[model samples]
Target: MIGLVLAAGAGRRLRPYTDTLPKALVPVDPAGEGTTTVLDLTLGNFAEVGLKDAAIVVGYRSEAVVERQAALEKKYGVKLHLVHNDKAEEWNNAYSLWCARDVIAEGVILANGDTVHPVSVERSLLDARGNGQQIILALDTVKTLADEEMKVVADPAKGVRRITKLMDPAAASGEYIGVTLIEPTAAAPLADALKATYERDPQLYYEDGYQELVDRGFQVDTAAIGTVSWVEIDNHDDLNRAREIACQY
Candidate 1:
C-alpha cells in the first residue's frame, strides 16, 4: 500500500501565508530544526510506518510542491508521486481524492494534508489491519465533539453507521481525524463514491464519500487514537495548535 495525501485545498481563510503556497506548505514547526510544513509531518509519519512510497494530490499553487518535491523526498526518505487536481480551487476534497484514484488503487493510508498528528495514529491503523475491515478511519473518540468536526456513529456489530460533518454533535460518538486506511477492495468503490459525491455537490467533503460507501453496504470501521495530540489546520487558531503539538513529535 502507498501513502496518499490530499493537499489541494486553497485554505482561503489562511491568507497571506496561503497566498503563494498551498495549505500543506504552511509551516507548523517554525522553531524546529528548520521549517516544517504539514506535508513534511505527514510524509515523515508515513515513512516511520514503513510506507515508503507516497502519492500527493496537489493544486492551487502546485508549483510550490513541485519545487520542493525532491527536497521533501530526501528529507522523509520516501518516493513521492504527484497527482494534479484540476478543480482543487473550484471544488472540495471529494474531487481532490478522486484525482488520485490511479495511484492509490493498490491500497493506501490516506491522510489530509492539513492535519498534524503523531506517527501513533498511523501505527494504530497499521496494527489493526488484521481486523479485516475494508476501510478503517483514525478516530478521536476522546475529544469533545463540535459541529465543525467530522463526526461518526458506529454500530457495535455493523461498524460505522454514519460519518459526516452535518451530524448533530450531541449524537456523535467521535470525530474522524482525516486519516483512513483503504484496502484494495474498497479503493475502487471509494473512488466511485467520491466521484458521485463531487458530482452531486462540489462543496461536499471527502467524508461524504465515506457516507456514500457506508450507504452502499460497505463496512467502514474505526480505530481510536486515544488522547493523541493532533490538529487539523484550518485557520489561525488551528495553525497555532498544530505548531504547539507538531514539535512534540
Candidate 2:
C-alpha cells in the first residue's frame, strides 16, 4: 500500500511558521536535528512500515514542499508523489483527500499531515487490515472524549455506526486519530463519498465523508490504537505535547 497524507491546510492558528509553510511543516520535535516538520516523521514512519511510495496532498505554501521534495525523498528513502489541491486555501480536507482519489486505488495508509504519531500506529493498521474490511480508521479508544475530537459510535459487529465531531462526546466509542487504511475495493465508493461530501459543504471535513459512507450503509471499520502517545497539532498546546513525545518515536 502507498502512504497518503493530507497536508494542505494553512493552519491559521500556527501563524509565522504556517505563514510560510503548511500545517504539516510545523516543527514538533524540539530535539530533532534539522527536522522542521511532522511530515518528516510521517515519511520516516511510512518507510519504517515498508511503504516506499507515498503521496502528499499539498496546498497553501505548497512551494515549500516542492523545494524540499528531493531532500525529503533522500532522507526517508521513500518516493514522494505530490497531489496538488487548488482549493486548499478556500476549503477543508474533504477536498484535499478527494484531490488524491487517483492514488486511492493503490491501497493506502492515510494519515492526517498535522498529526504526530509513531510508526507503530501504521504497523497496527497494517496488522489489523483484511477480514474483508474495506476501510479501517485508527481509533483512539483510550483517550478521553472532548467536544473538539472527531468522535465515533462503533459496533463490534456492525462497524462504525457514526463518525463526526458534532456528536455528543459521551456517546462516542472513541476518537478517530486521523489514520486510515483504505483498500482498493473501498476506493471507488470512498472517492464518490468524498466528492459528495465536499460538494455538499466546502467547509466539511473528510470524516464527514466517512459519515456519508455510514449513511450509505457502508461498513466502515475501526482499529483501536491502544494508549499510544500521539497528538493532532491544532494549536500551541498540542504542538507542545507533540514535542514531548515525537523524540521518542
Candidate 3:
C-alpha cells in the first residue's frame, strides 16, 4: 500500500506563509532542531507504519515541494511520488483526490496535508486492516463536536452512514480526522464517487465523496484515536496548536 497526502488546497486563511509556500510546507516547528513541515510529520507517520512509498498531490506553489522532494524522502525513508492537480486552486479537495486516481489502485493510507497527528493514529488504521472493511477512517469520537468539524454518523451494523459538515452537531458520532485507509477494492468506486462530487460542485470537500459512497451502500468504518492530540492547520490558531502537538511527537 502507498501513503497518499492531498496537499493541493491554497489555504487562503493563512496569508504570507502560504503566499510563497503551500500549507503543507508551512513550518509547524520553528524552534526545534530544524524546520519541520506538516508533510514531514505525515510522511514520518507513514514510514513508522511500514509504508515505504507515498504519493503527494500538489498544487498552489508546487515548487516548494519539488525543492524538498529528495530531503523529505531521505528524512522519512520513503519514496515520494508527486501528482499534480491542475485545478487545485480552482476547486476543493474532492477534485484533488480524484487527480490521484492512478495511485489509488495500489491501496492507500490517505491523509490530508494540513493535519498534524501522531504515528499512533496511522498505526491504528494499519492495525485495523484485514477486517473486511474497504474504507477505514481515523475518527476522533472523544473530541467534542463542533460545527466546522466533518461529522460522521455511523451505524453499528452499516458502518459510516453519513459524513458531512452540514449535519447537526448533536447527531454526529465523531469527527473524521482526514486519515483514511482505502483498500484496492474500494479505490475505483471511490474515485468514481469523487468525480461525481466535483462534477456537481467544485467547492465540495472530499468528505462529500465518502458520503456519496455511503449513499451507494459502501461501508466506511472507523478506527477511533481516543483522546489523541492532533490539529488541522487551517488558520493561525490551528497552526499554533499544531506546533504544540507536533512537539510531543
lDDT of 3: 0.91
Residue 151, candidate 1: C-alpha displacement in angstroms? 0.5
- TM-score of predicted structure 3: 0.97
What are the Cα lDDT values of the candidates?
A: 0.90, 0.91, 0.91
Q: Pairing residues by index, what is the TM-score of model 1?
A: 0.97
User: Candidate 1 lDDT, tens digit per residue, 13-89?
Assistant: 88888998899999898563338989999999999989889999999999999999999999989999999999898
User: All predictions: root-mean-square deviation over Cα?
Assistant: 1.3, 1.1, 1.2
Write model 2 residue lDDT over 60-128, tens digit each, in one string. 999999999999999999999999999999998998899999899999999999999988889889998
Worst 10 residues of 3 by lDDT: 25-34
